[model samples]
Target: MNTRELTYVKAFNEGMHQIMAEDPDVFLIGEDVAGYGGVFHMFDGLLTTFGDKRVKDTPIAEQAIIGLGVGAAARGLRPVCDLMFMDFIGVAMDQIFNQAAKMKYMFGGAVSVPLTITTAGGAGMSAAAQHSQSLEAWLAHIPGLKVAMPASPYDAKGLIVGAIRDDNPVIVVLNKKMLGVKGPVPEELYSIPLGVANIVCEGDDVTIVAIGRMVIEATKAAQALGEQGISAEVIDPRTVQPLDIDTIVTSAKKTNRVLIVHEAVQFGGIGAEISSQVQESAFDYLDAPVTRLAAPFAPVPYAPILENAYVPDAARIVAAARQLVERS
Candidate 1:
């Protein structure tokens, strides 16, 4: 296997650069994304390389950023708008939901927006309430917007390429915690289709469905469970909106037990949707109830200790999955 290490941030940056060079329609617009290289430095040198036309920077207004992207997209341009934080999606939901999302359908599928809205979300690093949020569930409920949460460097590259090429409005959430993570990634340009689930690790005892940064935590927990004689499967639903129910349900049925994990609050997170879908799709095959591991319903605390507690970690996932295995 061709293997090496690369941070998640680099993979995204490289992939964005590659697509922009190859496709004239592909461009980026966001706050500090061009000249400033973005808050996380994901687009550090892109503006210099692609010039102002492709690497455009805009004001801090979320609505205007998204509104401009919608107009650009409707004109056959593939515009990727960085929302900075997924929490700010609330401010631009109208442009995302009412315009970019519903445009093609409203026009009888004759026009395609071909837009990708990429944002970062998570509860680590003490970004606190205004910044840290796992809001994929909010956008996934909309019919026209595609939601993708890539967990690894490989997925980060492939999914971004896929999102840029997609005809509908897509929301790609890059968890702040996972940006520095390194993993084996391909050098060639490729695409991970929307609505696909990646089974990072597989076992027969229990299936763990994780999103974004939680996938790494779930894998670590699965290893710990292995030491205790529990075989846990780790499945990352790369795209939540176009959820791969078939893949997840099949894995759950084979194992007969399932655990849903995410960085979002327990209430109304994507974990509930996965849990409900598992129960509905594989109800007869389950040996035990599906359990979920998620942040509690509260703002993320700034203190390191409280912040650690606020986000679901490897230990908690191990404990939760082990309890389910014991019951089974």
Candidate 2:
């Protein structure tokens, strides 16, 4: 495979572009997506490449966009709808939670919606609480929705391609902070199947399960911990819904310690689900408590300093892991 460095947005655009060209049924719809190329330039020039019909834009309505995508999906067309910000999904909960997510099951498997919703989630760029919330947990809790939060550019393309190709609805949230981060991405189109986890780093001391933007910080924490001779393994669950619990359990078993990290608030977060799963499956392997590194249970603060404190950083993960190690 020919590989090259690409920003997260570039990788995402390339994946969508490649999939659209290969699949005649695949199309995209979102606000300002056609002419403006999306709010974050993630859809830059896609309108020109795919034209108005396939790269259609809509008014500022989240529910309308989901409705269109759901209809298209039910009619055998693969539609990738962009909500811009995942926080807006709250406004369209009925469309997502009641309709799009449950269509196939409700229809007794009469049809499947190869529907993919791409949005920006998690705080880092000071987008404030409205634009920066990691709601992967909310989506994952849904019976029929597949939730994915990619960490790096390489996985961004592969996981998105996989999500769009799946025979079910998938929610892929792109963290804005990672938009400009560059990493190795293959030139050819491919997919990282849903429910798979990547062993980003291997160690025998601790297993660090990080999602979205927290993966970058967790990686840094692992590197710094290496200096202290603390071996830490990092695992990124490419798709949160289909969890890939086995990989996490194996990693925790190997390390004997588990530390979950995410940009989401601590209470009622995805980490709790992961922590529970690990404890249930790998309780005997843990030499210490299953720790967590997450933001407090509060809205994302707008001030830079407060936001910085509100988000999990490399230092936070490192310190948490260090504490757990000391306790063990």
Candidate 3:
């Protein structure tokens, strides 16, 4: 594979640009996406490369953005709609959950909404409650939508390509905190299959299943646990909706303990679903109850310190894993 180091944001930009060049039907429409290169610089050179026709900018309306994407996708065009922030998904819930998500089912599989909604998520850099939030659970809750939360630049590039190729509506959630994080990504276009979880690290003591930015924390926690002679396996559920429960359950069964971590609020979060599935599949194999390490049920704070406190770090994950593993 031809690979090069790229930041998380750069990898996605490369993937989208590569796809747009390869497929004439794929286009991007969102607020400030063209001339402004997107709010996060996700479309820095896409507009100039694809031109105004394919890289059209839209009004400051999330509802209109998603509606246009749904309509375009239904009519046979692959549209990548950037919502800017995951928190804004609430504004376009009808278009997402009701329209784009239900198009194929509503049409009795006669139509496919091959639409990809890419948005930044997670709390860090003190984006505050309005702009910072990991709402993957909300999208995953809907039956028709596919949710992919990429933790690294390599995965970001591959996942975006897969999302674009998908015939169903896919939500690509990028953790804002990891925007600058760099990793080696293939120079050529490639796709990482959705719903497949990556076992980042193998261990036998405890299993830590993390999503998005939390994947980094989970790995760090695993390293720390290793120093203490506690082998902790880290699994990154790259795609949350079509969750790879088998991989998670298998790891949980081997480790006999599991810790689900995410930047989103613990209550009603995706962790709850993962924890429940693990328990159901590996109930007899588990030595302890599944532990969940997630942000408390509260708005993301604006202050850096508060934001740090709100999101779980490696230390917290390590502590939770130790508690889970040590329980007699």
TM-score on alpha carbons, each prediction = 0.97, 0.98, 0.98
- lDDT string, candidate 1, 119-161, tens digits: 9999888888889988888888888989999899999988999
Over 4 Å off, model 3: none
Please give the range of 10 consecutive residues that has the lowest summed lDDT in model 1. Answer: 1-10
Instruction: Tell me the lDDT of model 3 at 133.
Output: 91
Off by over 4 Å in 2: none
Better of 1 and 2 by TM-score: 2
Deviation of model 3 at 47, angstroms: 0.9
User: Which of candidates 1 and 3 reaches a greater lDDT?
Assistant: 3
lDDT of each: 0.90, 0.91, 0.92
lDDT of 2 by residue, 65-159 (tens): 99888988999999999999989999778888899889989899998888999999989778898988898888989999999888999999998
Question: In model 2, what lDDT does residue 160 have?
Answer: 89
Specify the highest-lDDT model's number: 3
The sequence of per-residue lDDT tens digits that candidate 3 reaches over residues 41-90 is 98899989989999989988999999999999999999999999898899
lDDT: the better of candidates 2 and 3: 3
